[model samples]
Target: MTRALLSAALLLLLLPGAPAQVSSQTSFTIVVSNSVTNAGNKTFSTFVSFRGILLGGMRRLQDKDSGFTFKYTEDDNYGPFLESVNGLAGCPNHRTYWELKVKKPDNKVILPDVGIGCYIPSAGDVVILNFNKY
Candidate 1:
C-alpha cells in the first residue's frame, strides 16, 4: 500500500535520526469549461497557481464519518486546491486537496456538487474544487 510504504519511509527516516520530509505536493493546470450546457456564458480560461492548496482526509462532507475534515489541503501561487474521495467503503467522503473559488467582485459561480451557492468570481473564478475522480 502507498500509505504503508510512506509510513515505512517515515519510520526509516526516524530510525536513522533523519528528518521526516513531507513530499512536495503535485501541481495541476485545472481548467473549468462551461460544459457547453452553460454554452459560452461561463468562463473558460487557464488560470495558473494563484496561491492554492490541496485538501483531503476526514474533513469529508459525510455524516457517517467521524465528523472530521480528513483531507489534504495545499496552497501555491494560484488558489487553494483539494482532492476529493467519495465515502464508499474504504473511501471517505473527503477532499484530497484544496480547490478554491477564486474571489470575484461581482460574479456568480455554481458548484454542481453541492449546488449551495451562486458564487461570483471577479478574479477569474477560481474553482472551489469539489469534483473528484478516483
Candidate 2:
C-alpha cells in the first residue's frame, strides 16, 4: 500500500497540470533620455513580478529612486498613456511626447505596439523613455 501511494504521488507531481517552481520576479534596466533637450541619459535598475507589465516596474522604480518619477492618465480606448517623466510633461502644442522603446538582451530595439500598461518587459530588457517630438 505504501509503494502504491508513492507511485501515485510521483505521477501526480509529473503531470502536466502540476505546478512547477518558477521565479516570481524579473530584473531589467530603464534608460531615461531627452532628445529635444539633449539631457544625459539616466539609467535605473528595477524589477517586476513574473509576466508583470512595464508600468509596474516603473512604479517600483519611482518608489525606490528619488531621481525617477512618472505620471500617466487613463484612456478609454488605449488604457494608460504616459504623460510625463521626471517632471517633464508632454505638450500637444509643442508636438512633444514621451516615446517608449525597448532594447532586448540581443541589442535589438523595438517600439512596442502596446503602451506601458500592457507591455510585459522581459529580463535584461533596457526600456528607454525618450522625450521627443512627433
Candidate 3:
C-alpha cells in the first residue's frame, strides 16, 4: 500500500510474540486473607477465584461491610485445580464458591471458582486475592 503502511507492517513482523508481552506462565500462588466466619445464622467464607486471569489476594465486598481476613498457601502446577476450604456436604450457609475458568481454543482449561481460587502459572509470576470472612 502506502510507504507508511509498508513500514508499519515491517515493524510488526520484526516483533516476536507481540500478542504476549513476555511468555507463558510458569508458577502461581494464591493468598487467601479470610477463610471463614460465623454470623447469626450463616457461616460463610469469602473467596476470589480465577485461572489465567490474575486476581486479588485481598478485596473488599464493600467499604462498609466488616469481615474477617485469613491466609493460605498454594503450590500447584498450571492446569486444572480447585482450591477450597472444607464445608458441610449439604449447607445453605455456603454460597456457591466463586470461580474463574479459562478454556483455550484447543479445549484446554484452567482455574476454578468455589474455594480460594485457581491459576495457570508462569515463572516468577505471583497472583494475589483478597477476601473477607462472611
Best by lDDT: 2
Weakest lDDT window of 10 consecutive positions for candidate 2? 15-24
Better of 1 and 3 by lDDT: 3
- Model 3 alpha-carbon drift over 4 Å, by segment: 2-4, 15-38, 41-66, 78-115, 119-134
TM-score of 1: 0.20
**Model 1 bad stretches (over 4 Å):** 1-68, 85-109, 112-134
Task: Give lDDT per model, in order.
Answer: 0.33, 0.96, 0.36
Expressed as tens digits, the lDDT of each residue in 1-134 for candidate 2 is: 99999999999889789456567899999999999999999999999889989999999999999999999999999999999999999999999999999999999999999999999999999999999999
For TM-score, candidate 2 versus 3, the one ahead is 2
Error of 3 at 4 (Å): 4.1
Q: State the displacement of the C-alpha of residue 79, model 2, in Å, after optimal TM-score superposition.
A: 0.5
Winner of 1 and 3 under TM-score:
3
* lDDT (10s digit) by residue, model 3, range 6-111: 9999988897853445533333333322333422322322223333433232332222224423333464654323333222121236643323333343445544
lDDT of 1 by residue, 12-89 (tens): 778747555655432322232222123222222232223322222112223333422223334454333333333211
The TM-scores, one per candidate, come to 0.20, 0.83, 0.28
Error of 3 at 2 (Å): 4.5
Instruction: Report the Cα lDDT for residue 110, model 2.
Output: 98
Cα displacement (angstroms), candidate 2, residue 132, comes to 0.3
